[model samples]
Target: MPYIKKDFIERLIDRVDIVDVIGARLTLKRSGSSYMCCCPFHNEKTPSFSVSQQKQFYNCFGCHKSGNVLGFIMDYDQLSFPEAVEQLAKEAGVQVEYEESAGHAPEKKEREVDFYDILERAALLFEAELPRHPEALKYLHDRGLSDDTLRRYHVGFAPESWDYLIKNLAGDNQKILKAMTDLGLVNQGQQGKVYDTFRNRVIIPIRDKRGRTIAFGGRVLDNSKPKYINSRESPVYKKGHELFNLDAIRNLRDKNLPYIMITEGYMDVIALEQAGIHNAVASLGTATTPEQMNLLFKQADRIIFCYDGDAAGRNAAWHALNTALPALSDDKQLQFCFLPPEHDPDTLVRSQGAKAMLDYLEHAESLPEYIIATLRNQYNVDDEGGRINCIDRAAEILSLMPDAILTRAAVEKRLADLVGWSQEGLHGSIDDSIEKLRARKAVRGPESTGAGGSGSRMDPNTIPLNPMRAVVARLVKDPELMRAIPEPDKLVAVLREYANDRCQVLLDLMGKIKANPDTTTGALLEKYRDSGKIGDLISLLAARSDAAIEEEGFVEIKIIDLMHYIKAILQEHLTARKQALRIKGRREGGLSNEELIEVQFLETATRQLQPSRKS
Candidate 1:
């Protein structure tokens, strides 16, 4: 085995505090000297996961899963050892320094920090400019925005000068210019640098849930071609993936709030919060995304989508509903609300008091009711054809849900009532819709393969010549197995005789393990540089646990299955080679004597390796 670095491994583990790590994800209360919370890893009615701050470890009595900070991150975030270490290091403010025997170590760039710093500097500059710039000051005053509101939202202004931000930083001019360009603050032109991005506009700093300014949205004071101009998509700013006012709402999330109200624009969110409703946010000039939904799920138990009562607003609400269905779970609830016609949240709050709005939200109809009402208004469902169309479209939407049994039944009963059809007839329609959904799923399922190599299946016989899957499966199950397979070269030799592209990754991992046999699972998984293959490796390892259970007390079946799989792969390879030879023979008239002898030797080897086929 390669030499294990005891000091580095122990140091990495020591740096992480399990209590703090687990506490961040769950609400932990003190129980004696330790902290306890209901395990997030499993659904439990009572607290079972315990964190011992003294020992720097956590144990779940329910699932019997126990580990330190590294294990917690690995299980919770699904991160690798190295990734968990890096995360913990960041959390603990510890810099992990490593040395290599060969070549110079590559210097790490703090891209996230650089982006945040540049944005912070830019925000400060913009805030300074707002007071000095006459046009910017006039614009805010014209909008009737209060001085307190401006300060509360941190509203600022970017000057019209092209080199305004560039000259102020006084650092590397090129580096500053590139950073601005990266943040979409400036554009590169054919003639020279041009200020094609934000200029002479009121800027609103877009923050993440952590209150870090990740990007910005700027709106023109005057009648401009594009009324609102947002920061171009950057490394930190994903317009669809983030929501405005999330930072503020996150602060108040632990108040046992049952739901959060989602508005149509930033102003609506700001106005709602100022009106005493703090749990409101707006999408960044775009529809919500799955990532945003996931973030919301982490905070609130329910979401109330508040859109304008106009046709466009209803359409936007429909789009959000469709995007949300696949992600909606039993624990999460989704509902929709619309303001009075021609009124947004901002206008409504001014006209109707916050109490009236809150009452409306409390008594608002569910999403299904809103959807049905909207459809009925659009199409007259009194007619037979119209009723049929409504059922068809509604069924299509419901089918997208992974577990819509109750929802489907409710919709079916409603449809039967509307269409004046029998309950049995509506039941039959739902069955048909379910069958259609199943057919669609089956068509999209992974293709199957046959032994003949002519069917429309992914041929299991043609395993790639990389044993990464096998190697990772074995390593995760029993890292001590590395003692038997000490060298990567020898492991490769064993793997090359079989099929599985994962073997290549496993060989690379083995090389690392041989160098550091004491390497923890966290470390091994973290150093795996290729993300494209990591998921596959993880799935393979997870599958091995089941395979191990099945193999217990039936050693012969395991060996036979492995041999059979290997033989099938070899057969596929040999078949392809024979076909290639036949094509070459057609081109060159016939095979040479030496080529024929080689073919005979390959055939003999294949025959010796082929396992008997049994029923």
Candidate 2:
């Protein structure tokens, strides 16, 4: 891949509106010189996060977290450095420009620069092929899809001929051939030859949030076990990360909407669209993934899972809900809507008009209600033993949801009244089960938002206390001040014990700031966002203390004094360690070579760093 020019990045940053970007995720109130919001990074009742439009930066009075537009997005959306830049650039409507650096290695598909263009051409090819296939068109028409709907969705077809696409779209160009293969549109056989991946099927284009055609799904004409086959995971397209018709609904997506409808197939999504329900999309031939759910929550406040009424549909709904439960935020909602037995969205919409389908969604069962009802159906609650079993099952599933959905107190009171068990007894039993569930799921990884990004239920006690809060807060809020201190290496050594989370990030950051004197705080933070808990730890530290001296000119003087204090602390630690080791060696037999070397080195390093003390 070509190197993205720093000039392009600088221009992109200059072009974006900080308020617009930050305001999208949060509500910002205008103050005298800045905007303020309750910092999303931490749990705070009072507003402390401040964004200064004049300086093109932000600093929290409570957390001391600070950066420009990119940093805010990286924190808010859990996006990596390049991802944030591209997203902001897209919002700003500025094209990303790249250049080749000398001796830089090219990506495998680097020469194939027109991946999106090729995908568009393939989509059009399928469209052009559809008109000739009367049987394919008839199948769609029989499903009650109007010509206008067909055109709007860009639904298409593929012929059974082995080399139809290869001959039509890919000629003699090896680069185009590789691009097609990369997209999984062309499959390689035993003889090292390529053949069309989709054949004798109705083609549906799968798109990204950006509306780009990243992959395709094809439905078989004849009855088959796997009625529909989708494109394999490619560089640009992963089934778990995308949804069918997401491109259609994304523009119509309104965050204020109570919930967006999630369907199981492309046809269902198109059916919903034809019925004038614009806030509906479907996962691409796979179970809904946490990443896709994260993307969905970014657009809407709630999600409604619409499944078929058959046993298969019920299983699909449960699988989706279970996969999505850990990622659900307290503020968001999820619901379920089922069609009649043997009925799917396409058939249901065709049989009864859009209004009838809308009625089902309008009265969709909420998650908690469904959980209770499903529990009752699964366990016989007429006896004492049955009630206990039912409660245990409920706890397992409910543990996946956050306290926002159903609190332990609410569960206790509700279960005691409903199940005829003592409130205290039931609460204690359920708490034990839920703790087991959390322990089992501790390693499943975090959700795609906030500082932790791990959407596991947050507890205030989990955040560590910052003993050197002021020094650490200054580094994050005003990174350039690190250079002003004469003893950064010693300062880091002294403060490492306090930063239990990704302390090496602090060390790496200081080194980078020292190397490139011109690196901005936002750029510096972006470099280490994915290294570990660096960004989260900094955000936590920022939330721990108020920004004492966040102003530009005055920060250096403050750092100079702080550095001397930290250096003195480092000396004390070193002297104390040496004395302890010496005493230990004398007590035992004599000094081990390693222990003696460490003591001597610490003493010498302490002497060298001592002379530059501010006093």
Candidate 3:
């Protein structure tokens, strides 16, 4: 097989449970919401190796080794990344799809072997030559890179001589020379002459997700004209799709951090990693692309783009935001962090420390905030014409967001507040804008349409209805009760209708419980400990635990009743919205075509939700 397809790996991983995988190898005793065993990698009397079934991850607190199932397999079984993947696929009883078929694989395999071998060999040569160059060694050392960091990243130096790589690696072999040229290690000049492409520069190899060296980036040692020289795009390397240090960051066990830090260059990633921030990656010396954004999303649910707090950086960030519009979803988050004018990620981390860098990242401007701020700076919201312009521009951008009801509604509400427009009026205008966007896209060509949903809530309805809050609290007391919730998607849709803070937490908690059937209350509490709501969760459980103790199976029964109540509320809300639309149609002459369709959808949904409880 050439390489295992990414989607196949993802599916295979999703099928296999971490508890089963680790329990089969090591005796895991239940410990709260996780399992515990003495770490196989380290000698310790205490069990420091903890496995979170909910997270599908393992961490050895003693030895500092932590990763997901695939990572554990790689470390424990002494297997390569591909071997671990194969092992999991076999256990999961799934067929692994390669990028190439067996009949056509041999040629591709040979090319891959040759290409990777050449890149690796070139990296080794540069590594060996680094110690011989005092200036290069000093430059890295002075910049706070330790011996371990340098070795870990495989940092190297390409000698000043133009023929260093060609003379050592390619020699007089025509095939080898051609391969090197194709790989961008050597370049062909005037009159068929050839020389090393990265002469007298610091070489850092860029590896793929599989940890295979595919390309190199070289930065100059002095104040040179072009400060950096990266390998030209070759068959093995595509710039837009790859992020520097991605292979390293993927090994992180807690990859689901609230946000992943996205930097602008290799050194920034390297510096951040060296500073004890392992959850960061760089966009490879270019504006972040849609493909890059998608890749980041696959790794984590959120991203915070870090850039200099300058005009150029703002421009670059604006481009990234526009590129990311199509990929926005209610489940995903995007933020931006603009650094001080004098510093990039590298300098900031070095000057202040990791804590400072993290503080900045944690407080980055969210996507909606950034959008509104950018518009506010560009337009005079006080003037009618300017406010109208802001509304129009906001509609165009907001319309590009995936048609998720709650997220769109939340953002549109913000826009409405800013432009002093009634929610009804703004909704109508945005619906029209959505149509125009689709019509224009239709004229151009076929493109993927996003999921759609309705937004806003009942005017007199108080959020976190006693039933909703009770359900969440009881689920916290007995997480398995989450399985009793029928039509979870619809349930989430209903919770999102309110868009309250408590509802957000409820939505996230319900999602986690649904994801893991074996979810325990302790594990649930652990997940929220850092969310600053642990005290509230504990209080909720304390206040409601007696009812569960007084009656057996009360939690599950109560959960079902609450779910019915929530759905009934949804039915009522939809009816009210539908009636409101009709009244607006009569008052404002007639509803738009989109509003007419929405009215019909609401009617159907409300009818379907007509109280089915047997009580």
Whole-model lDDT per candidate: 0.66, 0.73, 0.75
Q: What are the per-model C-alpha RMSD values against the true structure?
A: 10.0, 6.1, 14.7
Model 3 C-alpha lDDT per residue in residues 307-380, reported as the tens digit of each score: 99999999988899888877766567889999999999999999999999989988899887888789889889
Clash totals in order = 12, 5, 0
- Per-residue lDDT value at 130 in model 3: 93
Cα-based TM-score, every candidate: 0.67, 0.77, 0.59
Look at candidate 3 and give me any clashing residue pairs. Answer: none
How are the candidates ranked when ordered by TM-score, highest leading?
A: 2, 1, 3
Worst 10 residues of 3 by lDDT: 449-458
Model 2 pairs whose backbones collide = 63-542, 63-543, 446-454, 447-454, 447-455
Candidate 2 TM-score, C-alpha based? 0.77
Tens-digit lDDT string for candidate 2 (8-107) = 8776765666888888878999875568998765446899888766446666665455666887776565565677778898888877786655545466
Off by over 4 Å in 2: 1-30, 36-50, 53-68, 71-81, 86-106, 109-113, 132-138, 188-193, 220-226, 253-255, 403-414, 437-467, 480-511, 516-519, 542-615
